[model samples]
Target chain A: MTTATDKSAANSETTAGQWIRMYRQMVSVRLFEEQVNELYTRALMPGLAHLYIGEEAVAVGVCETLRADDYITSTHRGHGHCLAKGASPDRMFAELLGKEAGYCKGKGGSMHIADPATGNLGANAIVAGSVGIATGAALSAKRLGKDNVAVCFFGEGALGQGVLYEVMNVASLWKLPVIYVCENNLYTEYTHFSETTAGDIPARAAAFGLQAESVDGQDVRAVYATAGRLIDRARREGGPSFLVCNTYRYTGHHVGDINREYYRSKEEEKHWKTERDPLKLLADWLVAQGLADSTQFKRIQSEVEAEMKKAVEFAVAAPYPSVSEAGEDVYA
Target chain B: MLETLTRELTFGQAVREALAEEMRRDPRVCIFGEDVAEAGTPFKVLSGLVEEFGTERVLDTPISEAGFTGIAVGAAMTGLRPIVDIMFGDFITLTMDQMVNQAAKVHYMSGGAWKVPMVMRTTLGATRRSGAQHSQSLHAWFSHVPGLKVVMPSTPYDAKGLLKTAIRDENPVVFFEDKMMYTKLKGPVPTEEYTIPFGVADVKRVGRDITLVATSSMVQVALGAADLLEETGMSAEVVDPRTMWPLDEKTLIESAKKTSRVIVIDEGYERYGVTAEIAAVIAEGAFYNLDAPVKRMGAMHIPIPFSPPLEDATVPTEKSVFEVARKLCGQA
Candidate 1:
C-alpha cells in the first residue's frame, strides 16, 4: 500500500515536462468525455457512452508510463486510456460519431475504438472482457522475445469475473510481462462495488503469487510510479502484477443514467468532484512546485477544449461508411 | 491431387501432426490449455508436442477455459499464433464471450486493422458416457457468428490439412475434432506438405440418387449410410463441407441438384444447428432442381444421456441416416 506522502515522493522524480504533459492528457480525456456527453444530449451520437470524467488519473497515470508499442486492452469507459496511449482525438470522435474517419471506421462506436498504431488493442464493451486479451498479449511478448509489456485495464467490477483470476494465475505461472490495472471507481455501474465484491481485492491476485499493490487513483503520480515499477519488472521477466487504484465516478454510469440518486447520494458525487478531483489535485501540486501557474492551467484547459471542438467538428463532417462495407472485414 | 505416397494415421495422430508441422513451420505458433503440456491432455492427442516444442511454447493452464481462451485472442492480435484447447466442447459455454465478442469481432470491429489469427481446438462427440457435461457438438454456435470460421474435419487427411490452414489463416478459427474418431478413425495422410482450402467440399463417395451432406463425425456416418444405400440398390453421394462458416454452398447445391434429393447431417442439435443452415442453403439454392425437400438430421434436442443405449439414440447412426436417405429417395 502507498500513502499520500509516498505518492508525493514518487511524483518528485517525474520531469516537469512529463508532469505538464500528463496534466494536458488528463484534461484532454475530461474534455473529450464532456464532448461525448454533449453529443449524446444533442442526440448526435447513436449509442450509450460510459464517461470517464472522474477516473482520468488512473488511465492517464498508468498509460503515461507505457511506450507507443506497448499493448493495452480497455473497458467500455475507455476514452481516457485510448488518449493516454496516443490515440488521436479526431479519429476517436469520428468513431463515436459513427464516421468513416474513425479508428474502427465507425464499426465500433464509443465503446469499441481500436487503434493499432498506438497499440490500443481495442476497448471492449463486455464487463472484464479484455482481461484475457491483455494477458495473451503478454504471453506473445514473452514468446516472441519482445520487451514490451501489456496493461489489462478493468474496473473493480471485473474482479467478479473468473477470467481475471484465471489469467492472473497463468501470467504468474509463466512469468509473462503484463500488469492487471484495476480501477476501483467506487461504483460498478449503478451499484456500489462493495455490494458485489467479496473478500480482499488485492489478496485475490496475491493468492496467485502476483506482485499486488494498491494506490490512490486520484493521484496521477502515484499510479504512474507504481505502474512504471510493475511494467519495468514485467519487461525484465519479473512476471505479472495486480494494481488496485481506488477512485470514484463523477457521473452516472452512462449518459442516459440521470436518476443516479436512487443508487448513490448526490453528496458523495459532489465531495469527490470538489475535494478529490484529480485535475485540481495535480494542478495544485504543479503550482506548489512553482512549475505551473493559474494562467498556465487556464491556457492548458482552453487548448484542450479547442482541440476537442475541432475533433468533434471533423467527426461530425466525416462521411459514414458505404453500405457495402457492412459485409466487409467480417472475415479478415 | 498429389501423388498417393501416403501413410495411415489415426485422427488423433493426424491432429498432432498438424500441430507439429505448423509449429515447425512457424516460430510464432504456441499452445495453451489445461494439461496441454506434460499431461498432453486426457485424450493424449498432443502427447509429443511438449517434448518437441518445450514448455515455453506448449503451456498447461489451470482449468480456466475462458481465461486462456481470452488470452489467445490478444496474443493473436499482437504477434503470436495461438491454438487454445478447450478440453471438451461442452466447456465452450465458458468461452463464448472471448470467442464470440472478442476474437470473432476484433477484426471487423477494428475495421480490418486488427486480426485474431488464433485457433480454438476442442472435442465434439457423444457416447463416451462422460454424460451431458463432457459430451457436446457445439460447433454450430460458432458457425452462427459472422467473423468466426468453424472447421470440422472427418478424416485424418482432412484434419492435418485443414488444421494447418486454420493455423495460418488471419481470422479466428474453431476446429472441432470428434473425440470418438480420434482413436477409432484412421485414414491415409500425405508425407508431403499440403493444405486444404476452406469452403471446398470434399466428396467422400460419388453416387447419383441422393446427396448426403455431413460434417465431422457425421461424415463417417454418411459414408456408412452410403454403403448401406448401395446394398439396397440406391446410389448415394456423400459431401463434406469441412468448414461451416466459409461453407461450400456451391458444392452442396450442385450435389443436391445432381441427385435431386438432400439430407444434411451434423452431430449438433437439429434445431438452429449446422444441419438447419445447410438444409436452408440447399432449399434456397437448389429448390427448383431438388426432387424432394432437403432433410436434416442431427443430435436429438436434449442433454446427452449417460446410459449407453440412451446416449447412442441421441446422435444419428448409419442405420438411421440410411433409413432417412432411403425414404427421401422414394425406396422406403
Candidate 2:
C-alpha cells in the first residue's frame, strides 16, 4: 500500500540519511547471520545456531526506534536482536565460536549474548522468560520516573507460556512503558502455528486491556512505523503496547537441520521466499526510487563482511577466563 | 559506642531497625512485600517502615511473589539497592526460578559487569501456630545456589550488624530471620554503623566435649541445649554460622578439632539441608579428629503441621540438640 509519494511520509519524521544508517544496520545483521550459518555448516560453531535470515526486519525495525539506553530482552533465537541492539559483531561471533572474547566471555554462547552497557539484559534460552524480565525492567523505569521504555522480543510460540500472561497482566495493570514485540515467524521450531496456537495472539494481549496490533513483519518500514507509534505512545502516556509481526524463516529451525522433511513443504518455502523476501523487497524499493544504487549496497556489504572477519579474528585470539576466575565473578 | 547501648529489643525489631536505618541512610534502599505497609509483615519485622518512608519506598504488593521478587532483581541490577521482604521464607519456593536462576545468576552470568546489589529479608522458623505453608526453614535451598549470598542472624546485635552488612553488600543476599527469636531475644546493639563480615562464626559458648553448629533459631536452641549438656557434665561448644553460603568452615573445623566430636543442628529437614552440608564438611575435614560418627539434629522430614503440638514435635528442640550433643560426646 506504500506508494512513491508516501515515501516522503516515512521520510518526513526521519531523514533519508537516517534511513541509510538503518539500512546499513539491517544489512549488517543479515550478513552476520549468513556468516554464522556458514560457520555452523563448517562445524566451527557449537550447539544450536538459530538462523535469523528471514526475521531481520522485525529486529531491525523495532530496535531502530529505541535509544541505546533503553533495555531489551531477547529470545533463544536472538542473534539478530543482539546485533540490532548494538552488540559488537566480533564479540557476538566470538561467543558463537565459544572463544574467550565473546560478549559473555564464552560462558554464554550464541543464545545468551548480552551487553549490559548497551542495556541488553541477555537473551534467554527459556521461552517467554524474557517477558517477565522486561516487564520487571519497565517497573524499575516507572518507579524511578524515567521515560526509558523496555522492549521484550519473543517468538510466537511464547504465547503459550503462563508467565507471558502474568507479565502482560501486570504490565497493563500498572501501565508500564513497555513494548512487547512478538516475531511471529509462522512456526514454533518445526511445528506450524495452526498446530499449537489458539485464537488471535494480539487478542490475548488486548484481553489484558493493552494496545495491541498485528503488522506485516517482512516490511521493515511498516514494522518501524508501527513500533515508532507504539513507542511514542508509551513514552508520552506511560503505558504498554503489544505488536505481533507476521513473518517467516528461510531455513530450517537450526543450522544443518533440514526441516522440510518433517513439517513444511518446499512450495510453501518458495512461496514465502518469492513473495516476502524482506531484504530483496527493501533493496528493490530503494533502487527504484533512486535512494541508493547496487554499487553502494555492494560497498556496504563488503564493509560489513570485512568487519565480521576482523571480529572473528579478535575473538579467536582473545584469552579465555583464567581458572582462578572461576570464583571471582560469582559474587559482586 | 557499641558497648554503651543496652536494650531489650528482639531480633525482629533489630532487623526492622536495620532496614529503617539503611533506608534513612541511603535513599537508594527501599523495602516492599505483602503486609509490609500497614499489617507490618506477617513476622512484624518491617513494622513502622511504610509509615516512616511512605508507600513509595516501603511498598505493599499483591501476593505476586515471583513478579515482585523478579522486580527486585531488576531494580537491583539497575542500581537500586532494594531490601525486599518475603513475609514467610517458605513462600520463596514459588519464586525460586527468579530468585535462584535470575537473581543469583545475573551477576555471575554477566561476568561481573553487573552486580545484583539487593537484600531479600525473609523469615524461616516454625514456632508459630501457622500451618505448613507458613512455617518452614528452607535457608539451605538458597545456600545451595552458586551466586547467592545467604545470611541468617540469631541474635539482636548480629541481626542489626549483619542486616546492615547485607543491605550494603554488592551481591544478592537472602537474609533469613528466625520467627521464634523475634521477641524473646535481646542484645546490646550499636546505634552507629557496624558490620559483621561473612564467613565469620560467632562462638556462642566454648566447651571441650563436643562442637555444636547451629543456624538462626537453631543457634539459640543449641545454646539452651549446651546449658543442659553442661548440667549433665557434657561440655558442648556452640558455633553459629551467621552466614550460610560462604560458611564459616574454618571456625567450625577448629571447634571440631578442639572438641573432637560434632553435632550439626538446623530447623530445616535432615536430608540435603544445611545440617547435612555441615556434617559432610566435618566428616571430610575432621575425619581423623572425630571420636564417633558426626550427628545431625534437624526437623522431621515432613511439612510442618498446623497443630501446635505436632509442629513443636516436628521442629528440632533444645532437648533434641542436647541429646545429639550428648550422644556425640559419648556421655549418654
Candidate 3:
C-alpha cells in the first residue's frame, strides 16, 4: 500500500493544464485510429497495425512526465506511445502507406515506425525486445550524469520473457534511471492473461525489490499522477521503477480480424469501451472543472478530425519509394 | 619527418589502442561490455580502457549483453558512436533481436533519418578449448541480415585500421575476431591514424595457378597452404575479404577468372556457410572460365569440442585446405 504522504504528493502535482493536454492527446489518438481503420477497411492502406485504443492513458499519462530529450522504447502496439511522445501524424500515416515521406521512409510500416529526432528508438516487432533496450538507454543517461530517464513500454505478456528479469535485476542493481511501464491489456494476441501469465505483474516487480504500482488505466488523471511521481523519483534518485497500467485494447490484436469468438466476448469488450472509456473519463473531469464548455469540446473534436483527414490525404497521395532508395538508408 | 614507429603489438592490443585513440579523437565514441573495467575483459582485449577513458565511456555492464548492446544501439541512434564487446561471439545469439532487428535495420527502417553507427566486437572460433557453448563461428548468421556491415580482421594492422573505419562509418558493423590470433599475431601498425574502407578485398599474395578466398583466421591458414603449394610447384593467389557482408565479389570474380580455379576457406561449418554462397556465386558468374571445380574447405558439420585433437579435427587446418586445393587441381 502507498503511504498517505505519497498519495497526497501525487495529488498535489495535478494541474488543469496537464489534465487538458492528456485529454486532448487521448482524443486525438482515438480520432486518428478511427480514420486509419476506415482507410484500412477500404483497402486504401496496406499491411498490419496493432491498435492501442484502450491503452491511451498509459502512453499519455506517462509521456506527459518526460522531457523532450528523454528516450522511449516501445512494443508493436506503439502508435499511442509515438503520438504521446510527439510524432506527427502526417509522417506516421505516410509510413503506413509505404511512401517516401513516411517516418521510416516506408521501410518500417506500422510495427516499426520511429522518430529518433524525438527520442523514440522505434517500436519493435519482437515481443519483450525493447525492454532491455530501454534499460540500456537509461544506463546511458545515468552514465552521462544527466537527469534524463528512458521509459520502456511493453505488455504483461512480456513478463514471462527471461531477458525482462535479467534487465530488471541489473537496472535495480546499478541504479539505472529507467521506468518499466507494462501496459496490461488483458491479452497477448489470442491468449488470455490469466491462462498464460502466472502470478501478478506488480507482485513480480515488488519481488525484484523495486518500487511498484498499479494504476486504474481508465482514469487518465490517476495514471498521470502516479507516473509523474515515479518519473520524478527516477530523475532525482537515479534508479529504476516499475508500474503496471491495468488497461484493455478495443480492437483485435492486429488489423483485419473479422470475429472475436475465440477468446474474449463482445459483451466484455463493450463493457470496457462504454464504462471504462479513458477519453470519456477525462472529458467528464475537464467539463466538471469548468475548464471548457461542450461547444469548445465539439470544436476540438472537429479540429482533430480535420488534422486526421489531412494526414490521410497526404498518405494516400504520396508515392511509394523508388527501388533505388532501398540501398541509401543502410548507412547515414 | 617520416620517422618510422615500429612497436610490437598483439591483435588485442591493437584493438585497444584503436579504441583509445578513437575515443580521444572523437567524443562520440564509447565502449561497453562485461568485465571490461578492472576485471580486464574476458579476453583482455579491452585491458586498461576503463582507466584511460574512465568509467563513463568505457562502461562495465553487469552481464547484460542484450541490455548494453541495445543501449549502444540507442546511443548510436541518438548521435553517439558506441563500440560494444560481446565476451564471446556465440553470445551474440542472445542479443540477435537488438543486433539484427534494431541495430541493423534502424537506419533503413527510419527512412534514412537515423544511423546506427555502432560496432559489436565479439571473439570467434575455438582457441583455448572454451567448449561448444563458448566457441563458434556464426558470422554467417549476421551476414544473412540486411542493413548491417560485417568485418573480420586477422592482423594487428588490419584490426586497428578496420576497427577505426567501422567506428567512423554511418552504419552498424559486427567485428568478428579470432580468439586464437589475439595474442599470437604481430604486425607493423603505423602510429598515425588510418582507416580501410568496406566492400573491398586485400590481395595478400599474388599467384596464377588458383585463387584462394578466405576470411578471419582462415586467411592465415590459406597463406600457410599457399606456402606449402609454392614449394610443390603450384602457385596460388590469396584474397582476404576483410569485410564479409558487403563482399568484394568483383575482386573475387576477377581473381577466379584469371586463375581459372577457385577455392574457399572458412572457419565456420560447411553447409550454407559463406564459402558455399561464394562458390555458388562464382559457379554462376565465372563457370565457363573455371578450369576446375570450385572447392570449399570448412569445418565439419559439428559443434566445437573441448579436446585439443577433436577441436583441431573440427576446424579447417592448412593441411586440410591444401588437400582440398590439390583435389581441385586433380593432383591427388
State which candidate has the highest lDDT.
1
Supply every candidate's count of residue pairs whose N, Cα or C atoms clash at under 3 angstroms. Answer: 0, 0, 1
lDDT of 2 at A128: 76
Q: lDDT by residue for model 3 over B1-332, one digit each (tens)? A: 88878787889899988888899999878887888887778678887878887877877777778867777777777657888889888999888888987888878777777677889999888757888989899998898888889898978988999999888888889999999888898878888778888888999999899999988999999999999999888999999989887888888988999999999888877898989988887888888899988988777898888898888798888898888888788878
Give lDDT tens digits, candidate 2, residues B85-131: 88788889877877887888876666666678888888888868889
Highest TM-score scorer: 1
Residue A270 lDDT, candidate 2, scale 0-100: 91
Alpha-carbon local distance difference test for all models: 0.92, 0.82, 0.84
Native-to-model Cα distance after best TM-score fit, residue A234 in candidate 3, in Å: 2.1
TM-score of chain B of 1: 0.98
TM-score (C-alpha, index-matched) for candidate 2: 0.94
Tens digits of per-residue lDDT for model 3, A88-136 = 9999899888899998889889888888777887788888888766876
Clashing pairs in 2: none
Q: Which stretches of model 1 miss by more than 4 angstroms?
A: A1-10, B1-4
Model 2 regions more than 4 Å off: A1-11, B1-3
